[model samples]
Target: MTGSAGGRRARRLAIGTAVMLVLAGTNGPWLYRFGTERYHEYKINRPGYKAVNGHWDVVEFPKEYRQDTIHAVLLHTGKVLLVAGSGNNQDNFDAKRFDSRIWDPVKGTVKKVPTPADLFCTGHTQLADGDILIAGGTKRYERLKGDVKKAGGVMILYNENPDKPMTLPEGTRFTGKGNGKVFLSDDSVLIPRATKVFDRKTGRFLRNNPGYARVVVEAPKEGTRYETGTQDGYRIGGLTGADARNTYGIANKLGMDKRDFEGIRDAYEFDPVAERYIKVDPMNEARWYPTLTTLSDGRVLGVSGLDDIGQLVPGRNEVFDPATKTWTYTRHKRQFPTYPALFLLQNGKLFYSGSNAGYGPDDVGRDPGIWDVATNRFTRLAGLRDPDRMETSGTVLLPPAQDERFLVVGGGGVGESRLSTNRTRLIDLKAAEPRFVDGPRLAKGTRYPQISVLPDDSVLVSGGSEDYRGRGDSDIHQARIYDPASNSFRRVADPLVGRDYHAGSILLPDGRVMFFGSNPLFADKADSRPGVFEQRIEIYTPPYLYRDSRPSLSDGPRTIARGGTGTFTARRASAVRKVRLVRPSATTHVTDVDQRSVALDFTTSRDRITVTVPANRNLVPSGWYMVFAVDGRGTPSTARWVKVP
Candidate 1:
């Protein structure tokens, strides 16, 4: 009886031990399946579903934007605002075709709105509250008006009786006020008396005596103001509309008329959800061809650009205050050229990498350096191989936002040359005595490449061409991915359309990139000739989309406290290895002034995840960001918007 009982106990123990081992062996898979039920419910990993990698998909819009979309900004409401002011020509402005529209990619809806002013070639920045602050635009355009008669000897109105003998008979009178000359035609002697005679010596006019007036003299001075002479001639009380020359081309090749195309002092905020623009206080100084950069204090810095008079507004950098909805100028140390590539450093300094959209003179203001806004000082750096090629080049702040490193790639030659270069350079601003070091070269030389920072911290460089206006068959259809960790660039899929000149790109919320807008020379006009404005948009999905199962944030607070810890639940927390918050983008001319990716410290327990938010406003800034959960394989989940309050 004792032997039987012992054998039964041993059998029971063996069964219990075997059951424990099985449970232990299958624990990981079971927990993963339990946590990732939401991921599967979405049918993201369903059978027979082919997920493409690093592919470009062209999307059709229900409502096509008839006007060219030269400027684009991604709003926190998950809508993109596109603006093309005047469509690059005077005819479009006259036709009131300058437009602004909001595109909801998820619903495939587009809402067109009226643009108050010509915002073509404007500078834009995203405010902390997700409002867009746009500055500057083409107040006027440099256009060729119809030909005028080439008459410029000057003229003076004469009041003479019909019976009086003509002193200056059908000839030029070389003697007049201030030794000026006047041409007398056959009808000059049969003119009426002058009410006022302008004196060239004193630069003033004398009232004619009615009783003493009989035969009036024809002279260069003393005449009604007209458009027949130079612009100054009308201002000095001369023959206003007689045989005078207006502004004209300086006998250059093409013989195009030259006029001052000034920049507007306008500023405004665009509401993405409402698809409307609210006029804000105008900028203190007018800016055309400006660059808007977001600073650490949540104020937007407006730098560079031509003033109202078509002159460079140098040194005086303007800052937009959201609270006051006004702009304050910061007397900067050095004058930056128009659209200078300005990136805010982690240490509160501005780095001018010399990458600029060509607007000002080529000989001035392409020096790379760190500028101190408070002190108005610049710490210049050396070692750029081709500093002269900084015009229209593409520059980006590399991913892992904490790293104070930037890459400058591909630029055209100075001025109107349009020659592109494949040269690349990098600089680590945090390093002591930082200097630009050689980086990987591009497969094809391009100008105005749109370098978008991807969810996985990789940069997707797309668009651009080897020459201006994409001329000479220089449009590069291929796209490339830049890996910061590898310090290398590799070819990816190609986009359908060619983008250059006024083209732009923005990153969307769903881990996809939206590429839109391209204005070449004449834009969409009949006179645009061989040029075509790109109205269609293309969305690019990175290779990470086709990877293994992705994590999903099932629960989290919409508002996150800056420098505080927040708890959230991810359906696939087991696969999530890291957390990240990427700022929304406001992009134009390959200039994404506010795009940034910040890493978060996180810990996971089953389906629960807690993340530490960055405390420094300089690091994360008070604004809206797309919070993403990245898996071990570098695949990122569709982000959720989290506002840092």
Candidate 2:
């Protein structure tokens, strides 16, 4: 009886094994994927693997606190200011649901702040007092050609009267002299009085120069028949006597074409301590997608954006005086594409890196150059590879800002073209004739790569799409540590989340890097579903963090003036090899002109390390900076906040 039972059990086991094999054969792909994913998880989490390739962790805020963050700035208080401001959502903009959040990474807390305006696609930079100067934003969302219902375009209103300026109300009507079509202004227009011209050499009076204002106007009713084919003069309505004779409107080709996003003139300064925005003087020009760069004298330079009429700002730049809280037009006029990468030079000039976000004619203001802001003289630099593909490129002032070197990373063609380049260009502004030369190339053509300067002087270049806005699911998950000392890139761990357009990365005070924002065009390779904004912030822990215990810095001075010294206590001071004063980043849209790692001269004795800041104000702008002490093993201590006043 026992032998018979054993035989039956053995037969049953054989049958079960056969059935399992058949099931595996039918579901081979599913089983293979499951096994591969498990193995990958096991490999990446291993102690040895993490020590070499580092790791990435996603930080998802609570559902109620989640927002589509388009701009992020690291404040002196060690909290990140995430600004959304309608978040590129037409519905949110129409509903006036702007958003801002103060995220404390250390405490893992998120606080919602009331946003005053629609700051989407705005420009921001750190101020002398550690306040964030935020300028420009969306006034109206774009409407595609098919979506546009009314015939509308820019109408230039000319004022011939030299005695006074003219203010036209929102509903001001203009009737075309030729087409006989009537159009209404969408907003109030302030047209300055005409300039009375006189000959400079002779005392004779010359003809009056008309002062014009461009305003967006649309036909009251939607139809193809309302479109204008040629330039036409329009008669101003509700005007009499001299006003009617002096003011007239001229417009060309008013049609139901694609309407671009309009800009707002609103500007504000965000107080980090108070966690609120303080309204400041509006800019001279309404701008959308502008670049706010800190000037040498501590004033902020606002440049290059779509104007209130949805046209490119015509090279009219302005400056913001933080002390007076006023904006004044610059003595000169120079233009670039929107969000052009401009950096302050040691000589007080601005360096335009030829990297821009988008929206401009392809041939104009696209060259890398050294711009004399005061004189308005621009010396175009040469040797930039793939010059035509600079839109959406990432530019970085390489570590040790004193070197005056910059790196321009991957970019794509202007607008929605499929052209992209993997080339990385390096330019040494200190050279006799500054020009960009090719550096290491990326494995794949990339756009909107996030570059962060690490505490240890190595730059982490990571996350970009091979196509525009991550089209066709082309988000690159690769990350690399660029060694400036070697001028090479070493591939590191891959980021779990994909970052493309509208994405950026910031170096945290704790020596880690935090990445945020991604607005993809589609969800899948087939491009059927619309993409969602990546609200989950991802933190990258460098390989140095996983190697061994990091050094600790404490008891540091709060403020260290330029050319001054500050002492900090470190238990392992003798092991320290390098010190860096890294300015906190105000990053958005792959542009971060504020971030720079200035190498400091340091001497260690006993348990204390003293570091001296550079005297050059242009190199070390007056602001709060993260002081990091790196050991011989390239491991950096958690930063100590210090102010340069």
Candidate 3:
């Protein structure tokens, strides 16, 4: 009887095992994917793996505190200032719903600050007094050709009266002499007084060169019939006598074509401590995508942007005086594409990397060169590969400002083109003839790569799209550390989020890097759905931070003047082998002209470390900086804020 029972049980077990194998075969792919994902998570989270490749964590603010951040600046207070004016949202712009946020990364707190204007696509830089100088913004969003209903174009308003300027208010009508088409000014314009030109050789007057202003004018009603193709003189309405004769307008075309974004002249100074924006004198020119670079003398230089008339500024640059809180035009004229990567050289000249965000003629101002702002002379640099693919590229002043080396990262073709390059270029300004040479290549062609100078003297290059605006789901998730000492790139852990257009990274005070903003053109590989702006901020803790422990830095002087010394207490002072004075970053569109890691001469004692700041004003600009003490193992302590007054 026992033998019969054992045979029956064995038969039942065989039947069950066969049924289970059949079910597993039916769901093989799903089971494999689930197991693979679980294994990845477990591997990345492992302590051993983290110690080698670091890790990434996402910071998602509450729904009410979320914003479409377009620009981020690391303030002196260790809080990040996030600005998202209208946030590339046309609906928000129409409703005047601008946004700015102050986030404390350590405390995980967020606060909203009232934004005064549409600071979208504006330029910002760190000031001498720890304030952030913000200038330019969007005045009008772009309207595509098919979406444009009004017949509108640029109108050159002429003021022939040398005695006085003319101001034309919005809604001012202009009737063309030939076509008799009535077009109205979309915004108010101020035309300067006519310049009375005189012959240089003789005392006799040559003629009155009429002072003109370009304004966008549109037909009163929307239709293709109101479009005009030819140039015509226009009669000004509500003007009589001399006003009528002196204030006429001339326009070459007024057709229902695409209209690009217009810019505003609004400017402000953001006070980090007070957590408010102080209104300052507006810029001389309305700018949509400008760059604010710090001059050697401490004044702020504003350059390269789309003007109020939706055209390039025509090389008319300006300067901002912090003491006077005013802007004055520079004597020289030099044009560039919007947000050109201009860095200040130790010799007090400016270097243009030919890296720009967008907007300008392909042939004009596309060459990388050294610019003499004083004389308006540009000396072009040779050996730049893929020069035609410079738009959206990133330029970084390599670690140790004393070296005067720069690296230009990957970029894409001009305007919405699918072309991209994986080449990296390096230049040494200290050389007799500084020219670009090929460096390490990226795994894929990239654009909008975020480059940050780490405290350990290595640069972190991460995040970019292989196509324009990450179209076709081409956002690269890779990160690399470029060692200037080795002149090579080492691949690190991949980022969790995909960053492309409008994205940037900033080195935080805690020795980690923070990334913000990603404006992709499409969401899927097939480009079927419109892409959404990435609002979650991602923090990357480098491998150096995953070690056993970091050196502790404390009790440092709040201010250190140029060519001065400051002593700070560090328990692991003997292990501290390097000291770096890193300037805070103000980044947008992968352009960060403010950040540079300056090496400091240091001596370590039993329990204290003394560091000396460089005497060169151009090398170490007057501002607040993060003083980091790196141990022998390349572990950096939490930064101690120091002011270079």
Candidate 4:
């Protein structure tokens, strides 16, 4: 053999070895998972997954909130509104000491805002005018009688004046009603104050305190009137003790107390531009644990919550017309479980995904289905193996808005059981007969996992707990990015602080993610061991940001007409591959129904580009959207707000 021929053969062998090494290192055994479309479909829990690149940093907060922020919504003006009604602690509510702030992410400052009502546990949605309609919260706590029996404490379900017998959960309790003769259902009718009652059979309540049942009653009273055109005024009261207990907890008890909190029918419009909260016309009925979704017609739909009387607000769906700045009751009545994670289908229907933030009867509300707003009709979707475990879970409408697909991820077990789920599911609403299909699982089961739609079209799932709320050390700090194309999740960098219930994340206009808030049992107790309330702010920079030079918009109109085309200059136009308009997110309870990304059709030459707006209001609702120019490597530029009128 010739010496030159031998050298060429060795070179070919070296090249082949390098290629094999790259393939093995990148995907290993799961390389075939991405090899075909069928393979990708079944790659829900694929092994040897590729981890997405990202890093997190804890930012210094300008001032201490002193309260746990259980709710956060991003505003169009690039500031975040933080609300923690009563801070999940009634002591704050009793004193009328609430924490509401506007956090400027760019300036690292928080401006305190006074809340008109207890915004805690309320539903919210962004209006087309970029204002937030804050609905339903505690007016005040309610008092009820509880009888301690050998089996369990039986709570008199008289708060709402129920016609039938209703059972309350075991852990549900009320407190601070004043010391008196406690009543027991045993052979003994009366027990002295501060005496513990023992339930020998269940071995559960073995304390010296025998729970008592009493008929301490209070009538509904007229509340402070806000300027609403609905009626002369609204009344507040008749709420169950259980509803109060679930939200604000029993009034005025210290250390892990859960007995205070009531549902207030008061609603408000938070104007970010003016930085003021305007008391709006309240809802016709009260709602706690409700969900607010922006409809395609530019109206906001309010659904499923405990009424003023603390019963699940039944079949009375209302729509808030931003045009009129008022809530109009729908002629149709609908029943949805509390906080049913609802999404607006492109065809102008609501899809209830069986994801809730924990409330109501377990069995009835766990069904996932689609509902027509006009006729009030429902079509059930099957195939969720752990449908009952969706409490405190998170769901998102997959990006490119036109896809009409949804994803549900990470929920807890039934009824405050501390058990969470790692399962995730996906469904295509555009399917002929849509049903849930299994998707990739999380590293662990998470409760309150925040799902944010990233600019690159991948979904970011981060910050939750394996147990109920933020109990124990179960807070999950790790984050995952779901890639729809691959049908898999790439684990990303973990945050410094672990977040669970009440924690939230939103995609900043600058392409970074801002993580904030976590309200555990005693998360606000800084003196307590392990402290409380994951209050520090953290920002995550995705790997794409470090990949290549990002495209930037130098000059663009602040507003555009529907279906119109305009020219904008983007520096580094040669690197630009995609231009997108993303609606700023209004998030709470791990759900952001208003969030979406619409790709803009564009033609580019040199440093100038002409982009066409969405053809109609249905495609991209008339509102302010963050416009970005994404480079070929998928890194997005700092967004500029563009209003579609």
Candidate 5:
């Protein structure tokens, strides 16, 4: 009897060992599985996926909660808030820390949001009301015990004061608390798989538009609302109309295959008060990843995105009038907007830029073109502004009213595919001639979690998964800050965890960033995850003590940091156009370049149109892309274009 028992024990031990090896994924075995499971799918037709690259740089944050990725970072006053999400059930980095956050940047420490013993959640959404709705994740994502799967939707909500974070919201504090507001209302969030909300009802997902319409684009049969976009002129469906689905190219990257891609129409409306979704008539052909911007007329214009086969197609621009319930499509004479940025000038002229950039395939890369409504023409901006460059681009209109100058940041790099950028570019559209100025580069190769400039002139960057373990690797804490005035990063803060694939960064009247984090996958866990996919709120304040704008110093520093070839001599071109540079900032200029010719000074009664790059050694951070901006009244037509390596 004893011998028989020993043999059985031995058998059980061997099996457990094998299981551990499989789960631990020691070496190539783990790599192979990850590659096959996710990366392989992307590598199916494109080589870009196979070349998952990483640019190295030293990071000051040393402690690892086992998991950490900067997802969303925002700054307010002298404080900062960060929101981060986790891809793994453990929530910690790879193997540490829980997956949620609400951190203080200046404090240099993080506070964790504890999961109630009886509560379960996978994701969260934030509402403008300052409460976080935790819903839709695998309430039972981990409920499968020894075979039987047990999943439940346990959505919960939490609120914290940005100035004084909730030390025990009701009882416990959240790790991913501060930074921006999380979307929590049922109407504001979406569950890939149907999620069960508890309490007074967290709400549902609806599209908020000017016509005061609450739009809801239903999920495809068994489809998790993967992506959404609209175009003008083209039929609702691509190629043909009968099959002209209003949404074009909405697909699931991690879900079921074959049905991975779908086309869509160009029109939609939502009724916020009613909490209902209604799809309007279709616009035109299939346009994927189109940018929707609200014009001064309260209309929305979607710029150049792309079609199937990953190519930039014509028939791109579309305009929608909510009041009139009408949508118009326009075919611009410029290159298709692959991943371009849209800027609305005070004069009402629209500026497009930073979309899928082209290179060896000149035809495609050369497609980066800018369209001017006033001139009704497409003229590519001079300098690094190239066609075919589909960088992850967006525009920032400065000041209270938001007019005149615009800031354009990273969108891929020289000769790289669009959708990503490494350097920052400043577009001075207010100048006689709009030009691209060099700003700062991002930390190494990481891309998403999105970036937003706060009301106080500070740059907030957050969230994005690492290549392989990229999802979980990108916790909400991957947050950082950049001070444009000093051209330097101001320490780290806590953030949230999640890919934030299609979340909207709405600017609140209180100056807080309204962050909406959503996943476009129809995974079962998302359904069971209590909060679903929607908004998550976090309040962020910068650490730098704003000492009011310093008065211009006479004969100060005479330097411009242009990547490698050294500074340009400003002597011959010392005069900056008052209409373009000096006047905006009410500042004047004394110009010279490389010390020998790049020194220039200016006075300003108003904010300058752009700023100049300092030309001193160690003047800027390495691996940082440099953008030169003037304070006010300078000729943008003569703005220099360069990047520091």
Candidate 6:
């Protein structure tokens, strides 16, 4: 004890003194509760593996994701990493059963990234340093049947530098966060609600030094609880800052939370020295599940989210000025559905990749404004290919000459009778009109398959459950690669775990791609075991490794089989970019590829490029079979229609 005021006097004390301490005291400014509590269990266990086939566009196809799935995906370097988890499993903490695995397209093998027991939901991200940073995520019990509230947000650092054999760094349990974005900063991370301070060097959630907040408020010398008329009851006046009440600001206008106004939150900076989270300025729209993209100019562009839905009122998009706490409305208006795909172009143009709002039959005549950043005005991008029909997902492709176009992919649309599309398209800005180019028909099945284009123009179409109409098979683990140059496909390794919903696909910096599946297998004739959800991750490379054989022609080419020049239905070697054939060319008029086959009504033929036999007057005409493929690029394949009956 020290005696002050007059002269400091040191008092002699006993030898030993014990000081009790609690761990939570270290990081306790904010308290948050997160996780699935409705059922006390998460239903969809397996997360799906995301692929940025060719250029990353399009979202999960409906037919493909009808099974079950994981969440987001990333394509880094060459390897693909997918986040998948299983809530039905007895051991929730098993990374093997939950984390991701790398698929080697070269070796044709799958390997897992070794991780801590609590590493589920696949929050791991690779840093520039080559170390994989497994950021905070929920923890499932290692052996327990039910979901338990263990650690909210914990970060486990791992290293896969050489990558030959991956390495898991030591674990440091960070107590405060739940589920949020793990932004890669210089050395540390700008983690949302990160309460605990972790030491990357020491590999531990440290409790030493000024790693905590210590409150020391001045106490008035009074009669304690029995005191009266002392203004001691707790005052909450400061919660509303003086500048907010005095200045001409929107906050003053929104005295109470209003339905008309967007609910905006401010940017907060965590001061390690003060151990406190200081609020700067709130975002324009107080939105959740929102997306923020950092621009080339270093400004973060926040966009599309469900702010005003029906009577509930959701958020649109607004920009935030970090220096000041004010929000600027960027005028991003929405109509019906709010889920849109965003793409930042290299040309410094912010291209909106979704639909122009108010689009019902009754709303078709209404015109929406196209955004022009230069004048801050909305103009018309007439020649632009908009995803008006299907809500398409697309990404910016980084190729040397790919500066003028965007590779757009997937979306669901009403098909003929019971048919639908799992195909992708492209928009070439290089063209004066920037028209859309419909892609080739996807492999036999629907959804679950993706297209990732390599530097060689070959696309890696991955995991999607397709219904084999003739075989009665609802799901197929088939994978294939399509070369645009040859317009042919070759089979690759299919996924062991079928992909379902909430699946994401990303392109890695390397060539290797990863696929992760979520939930139990929901494919047709699937194994409905309790823990069948693939919390597993696998990697994939192209199939060109195993076989170096050339893409041989199906036997040889000769227009229509012998016996006849086929129907020789006037056709030629020509261009077929955006043309959709609905009727056969009139025998009086000629067209591109000669049609060898025909139906009863030669005028309204549904199928194109068929092989037709000569007048089979000698015998009853043979039954017809649809064409599997054709040599459209050059020379003829079959000369006559071969009889099936």
Give the alpha-carbon lDDT of every model. 0.73, 0.94, 0.94, 0.72, 0.34, 0.31
The residue-by-residue lDDT of candidate 5 on 1-645, one tens digit each, is 356888989989999989877777657677678778685345432433212210111113334422232223222122222333333233433343334334443364544443222111111111111122221111112212233111111122221111211111111111112221111111221112223333456466433211111111222233323212221121111123422222111111122222111123434332222322244555543344344443544455654443322234464566665556566765454444333445444444555554321212345433333556534576777755422223333344432222344444443333322234445566565568767776666563433335554434454565432221123332234555555556555445444335333333432222233343444233233233233333333444333212222112222223324322232333212333221111010000000000001222322333222334333322221111212232222112222323222
Error of 5 at 548 (Å): 18
Q: Compared with the true structure, what per-residue lDDT tens digits does model 6 show for residues 405-504?
A: 4444443321111232455555555566665566655564343343444323345555544321101234345566665545455665455555432233
Report the alpha-carbon TM-score of model 5 versus the true structure. 0.40
TM-score per candidate: 0.76, 0.98, 0.97, 0.74, 0.40, 0.39
Alpha-carbon shift of residue 212 in model 1 (angstroms): 40
On residues 281-324, what C-alpha lDDT tens digit does candidate 1 reach at each position? 99977788899987878788988887654567766778999999
Root mean square deviation (Cα) for candidate 1: 17.3
RMSD, candidate 5, Å: 22.3
Of the two candidates 2 and 4, the one with more favorable TM-score, higher being better, is 2
C-alpha displacement of 242 in model 3, angstroms? 2.4
Off by over 4 Å in 4: 1-52, 63-66, 141-261, 522-531
lDDT of 4: 0.72
For all candidates, the clash counts are 11, 0, 0, 20, 207, 76
Residue 498: error of model 3 in Å?
0.7
Indicate which candidate wins on TM-score. Answer: 2
Candidate 6: regions farther than 4 A off:
1-289, 307-315, 320-339, 355-389, 392-403, 413-419, 465-476, 484-493, 506-510, 519-532, 545-645
